[model samples]
Target: MFNVSDGVPAGGEPVAVTFAAVFVALFVAHQVGDHWIQTQHQASHKGDAGWSGRWACVKHVLTYCATAMVSLAGLAAVTGWCPDGVPAVVGMAVSGVSHFVIDRRWPLRWLADRLGKCPDWLERGGGLYALDQSAHIGFLFIAALVMAS
Candidate 1:
């Protein structure tokens, strides 16, 4: 039988570095993908007016930065450099799931309807992008913790 525990030592610098690098790479990739999507959306929309486009751009940039920070914190905890593991994992997972759901334009559309508002393209796009970025960060954090352990 191939035991997962056998692959890792109790704790080590190698695991820490690997975990950090992987998490960071995943975050950066998400940001890049988000930016690409936004650019495409802009091109397709062409001459749409109002603050919606600008808001979407700003929201994505800010969300990406926040996600990166959260991922880093989770990575730090997983490396044993920080004293918390479960909380970090939980936080990352929550953030990740929220991101995924939001990006897919799920419950948000329903909520907006309840408030008597239609779902705009910007709202849908921004939610989907944010959710995806969050999911990536969460998955990377979980992977790092498991591998480090």
Candidate 2:
């Protein structure tokens, strides 16, 4: 979907600018929300084997979504690119669901196995963390595209 109207990326469209801005804004917010805003309890318990774990993950996702929304608001405040309506809703929905699924931890592990990533590397090395961050950024790009559209 990386279409260009001119010879350059995004073709200098307002929507393209919005997409780039939204992606960067959300990336910054994701870092802040996951690392700084997420609580120790949530981080420790989110992957546990019970409702408590699910609840912890839910709380984390809630706060994460809130952080993202605030970041979008801040973007609007500075650049006047107000994103609303169905596109924004759907974009955030995609983000929230993706975040929740990934934070559960098992889904990623399962996917890694299915993709034939070395289990030892996934567990012992930084591969899983790198995969997790990359996945989040990939989904964020989709969300930003939706919002810009």
Candidate 3:
């Protein structure tokens, strides 16, 4: 899956494939993460009242946008789309692992600690949030390879 030549157009720029992969992966990540938070953890609205809750949601969305931008920048660097010749496998591995560690595990733990709760839906196996997160990471890794190639 990491093979660049597999998906890249012969002698053409590889930006489109890479961009698509990133977008898809990020969407998957959000779906899985949001589902986990909603079903399992009970969406913790940080503020009181409808307006406040909406504001909080907006803030959360902004945070996610920032994360996506940073991930893309890092991915571009690791893929050597700038420097060139960097090992695609290494780039994929790094991005995947970092996302798993930082986004899922760490944030879940932190939110649980701060909010005084863990995802109850996760215990029920309603939609396989764990698998979703894993798949999201895997997709990002594959996307990185496709882009790099």
Residue-wise lDDT of candidate 3 within 13-118, one digit each (tens)? Answer: 4656555555554555455444533322124552224565555544544444445545555655665334133544454445444443433334444544576544
- Location of the lowest summed lDDT over 10 successive residues in candidate 1: 1-10
**Candidate 3 stretches greater than 4 Å from native:** 1-12, 24-42, 46-49, 81-149
Model 3 has an lDDT value of 0.48
- The better candidate by TM-score, 2 or 3, is 2
Cα lDDT of model 1 overall?
A: 0.49
lDDT of 2 at 143: 94
| Root-mean-square deviation per candidate | 11.1, 4.3, 12.1
lDDT of each: 0.49, 0.85, 0.48
Q: How does model 2 score by TM-score?
A: 0.89
- Please give the lDDT score at residue 53 for candidate 3: 55
C-alpha positional error of residue 22 in candidate 2 after TM-score superposition, expressed in Å? 0.7
Q: TM-score for each prediction?
A: 0.34, 0.89, 0.36
Residue 99, model 1, lDDT: 47
lDDT of 3 at 71: 53
- What TM-score would you give candidate 1 relative to the actual structure? 0.34
